[model samples]
Target: MTAATQPRSVNSAAADDVAPIVQRLRETYARWTRRTPIEQMRDDWDELFRSRAQPWRINGFEAGGVAAEWIMAPDARANRTILYLHGGGFRMGSIDSHRDLMQRLSIAAGARVLGINYRLGPEHVFPAAVEDALSGYRWLLDSGVRSGSIAFAGDSAGGGLVLACMFAARAANLELPSAACLMSPWTDLAATGATFLSRADVDPLHQRPMILSMAKAYLGPSGNPLDPLASPLYGDLERLPPLLIQCGDCETILDDSVRLADRAAKAGVAAELEVYPSMIHVFQAYGELHAARQALASAGRFLGRYFTEQDKRPPEGRGDTRDCG
Candidate 1:
């Protein structure tokens, strides 16, 4: 078969092995959606995720009035760090909700991780989360973390926020992060991607209605759905930092990752897109899945490469070299 028409396969065996786990996840999500009210969903999610114990040493702090947490990793690079935003449609997720994932990310990237508890929807609404994200990143810079040495990362809605953050930072003339990694980013708030319907049956956690509802909640009634800060797919991606995107073929948001990668690459930015077969949204957070581990490791290698390159580059002309001392 020709390259374009060839049957693609990556980790098919592993996908088959994880089918049962994915099924359970699907069933659980179905139950959650059916029984939970929209207003209670955030606290419900917080309680559910908080109940799961994490094995990492985490500490709490504040950045620009935003609550944040740090997942400490041993043997971590002193200067390199990750600013992580959690995914929950910009409404539900919190620092505790993603600590396990943060711990794994810290260990994999060999860098400390700062998980930002950005304001959520149906409460703070549009621009609040994005503002909080920028504030956290600025706090990192102010606290001695060079932009060139830090990487920005997030999953789902958080992933989209990471891209939005990049755009805002670039516009402000601040030095961009060395790299960014996104997992199943919700880049299009318009819900216009073909996969939203084509892959609806396969996606375990999302449906178009729920996606639209979350987007509306986060964007507010008057907010523009295509606002670049709200939906990064509409933004100019030129000159942004190198990007790494991971998505599962089965996800409704798969096209978001694909399209973002295409846009970034077309705009002359270095980008890498990895699609996992038969996987669901943000599969990297599921510790039971092999693809999750593989994706994290790949992200780690990607981060390490950029970090090393940033270290070797000449300090002159790079605006990130301001002495923190």
Candidate 2:
């Protein structure tokens, strides 16, 4: 699990609303050294969102063969869609675990968000999640959703799946979506990013061994760690849709986003990278976090125009990459 180290500057101040949440998570995390039952985790995940009340129009339906739900903010556009993939290392997470985030993104992007309950690993392994995600995309296309009107967005492992879904879609000869936004994406399941060491003392949530164990569970015993679909950081990035990658300097997988943006640039893709100072994995999940709201707003502005073909896109590989915190 080694790779070339890249220089990343740090910013000391984390948003005031974020520190307490991170501290709580860190304390709670210290108690669980091993995986918890998926059912219990699922309940806990949903419970975190229960305290936040929002009037969202949620509808349940099947996307391809997978069970899913459409989360729409009151004024969300019906024509445009954001296919959201939830993240729990591909082993946990479902529509329930992610409704709050999905609802927020739907409003931010002003598009309906279709979130799927993709099969989890250790029970459903690699390609199963990928396949379910693709099925949701297929359902969108079949239902006459224009490719340009749809955007792909996800966080952590789900963020990686956003890229994997596009790759899978390209292979199936389907049209690519307008753009994508990844939040603290776990692009390298191979756990090779130098940040696994560099950010070790900073990121409170993840470590190399933990990531490797999650990867092994998702990939099964024989799956290749470098399989392009499983680890999009190792995949070919040529001719994919425009990308907006948001990462935090304090996260162990920060390098995954940095290197991903580099690969996207080298492959002639339009990529924007924003590194927030002193943030952690999926910090966007915390509604109270100001940086979280800012990141989602940035993603909204990036993907908003695409929903209506009003793309006043900045040129590829522009100077938008920076410490935006």
Candidate 1: segments with Cα more than 4 A from true spot: 1-9, 12-39, 51-53, 308-325
Candidate 1 lDDT, 1-325, residue by residue in tens? 1222222234644543557766665554555655587556666666655655476555676876789877756656666789999999987888877888888898899777888899887778989999999999999888877888899999999999999998888888889999999988999999899898899988767889989988998999899989999999999999888888888899887778777887777788888888889888887877767888888998999998888454555443313322211
> For candidate 1, what's the RMSD?
4.9
Q: What digit string (tens of lDDT, one per residue) describes model 2 on residues 1-325?
A: 1122233333334544566887776655555535677666656656666556376545777878889887777677666688999998887777877888888888788777888899997789998999999999998888777798789999999999999999999999999998899988988888889899999998777899989989999999889989999999999899898898888888888889999988888888878888888778898888787787888887889888666543334322211112111
Evaluate all candidate structures by whole-model CA lDDT and list the values in order: 0.81, 0.81
Error of 1 at 34 (Å): 9.0
Residue pairs that clash (backbone atoms under 3 angstroms), model 1: none
lDDT of 1: 0.81
RMSD of every prediction: 4.9, 7.5
Clashing pairs in 2: none
